[model samples]
Target: MCHIASGWLYGGICRSKLRRHYSLPEAPCSDSLIHCCCRACALTQEYTELKIRGVDPSIGWKANVEKWNREGLEPPIVAPGMAR
Candidate 1:
């Protein structure tokens, strides 16, 4: 599992409002915690590009995971599992 900015999945605030958003089982924010199984799909390109650059893959993964944990960017349940 991974975490990403909600806007990346839902587009910006305008798009968020345009769609009929719904909540998840353990959503942290009632208004903005729209569940998106496609969230990881949204990050594939960026992750791959970083990998192609020979960067430490864990760096990007950890940064996004940390951000989501700190900001409650998505539902608590949607956040990445504990680091192995």
Candidate 2:
């Protein structure tokens, strides 16, 4: 049940990026099916890709946010009326 939901979410995310950023016409349907059977491998690939792109996932979100603040990086924008 979790795999089904997660696969759908990630597949939508990957497909959106592939089409908009990479100019890809189609993402394979088999990718979602594969994710159902092999979620760990799918997430491993995602982690590896993030690492290759110079982002460290191990430090996690809150720590990374603090680090970015200390480094004087721009904070992410919040939508109007949204709490920080």
Candidate 3:
């Protein structure tokens, strides 16, 4: 992505057709973007909320479900033995 951006910013130094029509500005320094800090704070808040809810934010639910199924655990029987 950075290479593509650089090519577009510098007028296609590498003869990339994709960089021809688009003009991009030089990338900003990290200090120039307030949104970077906001993203970090939002990520921290999400983890805190997950901890409060007693869920491991690191483990995805789909992966957990797949692991459980691999271990021969059936999905929850909603009606307690009703036929499918």
Q: In model 2, which regions exceed 4 Å deviation?
A: 1-26, 73-84
Better of 1 and 2 by lDDT: 2
Report the CA-based lDDT of candidate 2 relative to the real structure: 0.58
Better of 2 and 3 by lDDT: 2
Question: What is each predicted model's overall lDDT from 0 to 1?
Answer: 0.42, 0.58, 0.42
- Report the number of the highest-TM-score candidate: 2
Instruction: Give the Cα error of residue 15 in candidate 2, in Å.
Output: 9.1
Compose the digit string of candidate 3's lDDT tens values, residues 31-57: 213223354553564457445544455
The superposed Cα distance between candidate 2 and the true structure at residue 43, in angstroms, equals 0.9
- Of candidate 2, the 10-residue stretch with the lowest lDDT total is 75-84
Span of 10 residues, lowest total lDDT, candidate 1 = 18-27
Cα lDDT of model 2 by residue, 1-84, tens digit: 887567656865674553344233343455556456667776776667555544577997578778778999754433233235
**TM-scores vs. true structure, each candidate:** 0.26, 0.46, 0.32
Ranking of all candidate structures by their TM-score, best first: 2, 3, 1
**For residues 1-84, could you state the per-residue lDDT of candidate 1 as single tens digits?**
234545544442433442232221222432233334344542453346445534345765567667667877752232232354
Clashes of each: 0, 0, 0
Best by lDDT: 2
